[model samples]
Target: MIKIFTTIFLLIIGSTGFAIADTDYQLHAELIAKNTYVFIGKKEDFSMVNGGNILNTAFIVTNEGVVLIDSGPSYQYALQAKAAINEITDKPVIKIFITHSHPDHFLGNQVFPDASIYALPTTIRELKTNAESFLDNVYRLADYWMAGTEVSINSILPLNSTSELIGEHSLRYLFLKGHTAADLAILDETTGVLFTGDLVFHNRAATTPHANIEAWLLSLDKLEQIRFNLLVPGHGEVTGNISPIKQTREYLTWLDVTIKRSVMDGLSMNEVINLPVPEQFQNLAVLKSEFMRSVIHRYPIYEKTLFEQIE
Candidate 1:
């Protein structure tokens, strides 16, 4: 009996150690301007591993208080973000704008108690119905150690077809259905900066798992009509002018054409996976293998001719 108990104890200890070994956290903070800053949480590159660090969280701050763009994946991340923001400014976070309902974008919302939270109506519904599964998946599939912990999500500010003015900026909420039914972009007219959330990726591949490829392509074109001096993407670095937006449009166009052709030709998903990106898109940061997988996962719905698409 003593031997059996001793073995179980050793196994438990070993299991605990393994869990700790699998978790890693790193946060990056950059000041975009005198009054605005962007904080990002980085995890280990998991493209090589089956399920490793795969998501990043971004925060945007202003003088009145802080307007959190997307919460990180876990409570620890939320805490880290709060601490980082405190270092930048002493004001309480006034509002949190969830770009969508994705767990990575909103799970860390638990950290802020004094803020009014805003999200699309669809996002609020999705969170109510799917937050449980979302939390479970993060715990099971995420590479970070804090995935096993529970994250609290509270207060849903749902916007159907309206814009909110915060401070000197008017946050025009645009409903984009492609990436997720409730994906939103925060357009700041004061600085001509568009907080694109996940609508565009600066240097990395855009995640399209829950995206509508056709609508996403069209959304890109619509964004081009709007003028913005800077774009704060959900992932990768911030971009200037309209070049990155144009590049995203081009890539989506190529993806729609290439993948649709492969699908019609009876090519298996694996074959489509091996398709090479166009030479023009080779220079974009998100076209690499890791981001390519994210794109391929949502390849089926994105059907359109390259010529019909614009850059």
Candidate 2:
């Protein structure tokens, strides 16, 4: 009886059995390429509007099994994502690669406890320091959807940084230090899909609470040289062309320059925060709020630099 009722609830949420219940998090997925699928999240922060479904998580169906790029926000969302993957294929998820230590990317680690979860040692270390606190924040912000969730650390992540084989598929791992203290990007050579975790936000303004803008810009230059036909960003819709990366580059560059200019002018942080949105970036998703967040994150460093120059 409970199973039947849950199915009915899932159908009502338009999950078609992908979602476990009609909780606040209603996960919906779409196929971006052959054997490649991604969950489209709201281009906003974790809030009631989207119910914490604000990060893109993807999986590539392989001949041997399924390979999940990053888990979703909570244990419940991970369960929903797993169900969604099952809806498309019967293969059990054998390997999970974390792109970064962000809460949205790894909180669902418990759902795939049986699967091998992989990440850089740096990523694992960062998660070790911040995972519990980040999980607590998520639980408070998205309480209803996070009722049964808890942080699950991947003990195997520190084993190595070498590339792994998923059946016959070869996934190349690139360790990058931008967007966060430790960020890893993956390229599925079989499908030509590059999963750039938090490093690139398509149409949405990126959250830079943990970013090194200079390092991020350098990473962008390297990303431009990657040969891929499809890009599945950490947030926003998937794209066939690399325009999204170029667009992200523009926004990041603009923010970097704008912050420096504000500091050079000796402008107060409030002044920088209140600056009008750039005409080029006005149309992007979540501009105002995210721009302010970026200023708040980056202004301190610039202010400190100015103080040193004065002294």
- lDDT values of the candidates? 0.66, 0.82
Query: What C-alpha lDDT, on a 0 to 100 scale, does residue 124 get in candidate 1?
Result: 86
Query: Number of the top candidate by lDDT?
Result: 2
For model 2, the superposed segments whose C-alpha errors exceed 4 Å read 1-24, 154-156
Residue 191 CA displacement from its true place in model 1, Å: 2.5
- The candidate scoring highest on TM-score is 2
Off by over 4 Å in 1: 1-24, 41-63, 147-151, 283-311
Candidate 1 TM-score over all chains jointly: 0.79
As a whole number from 0 to 100, the lDDT of residue 140 in candidate 2 is: 61
Each model's TM-score?
0.79, 0.90
Worst 10-residue stretch by lDDT in candidate 1?
43-52
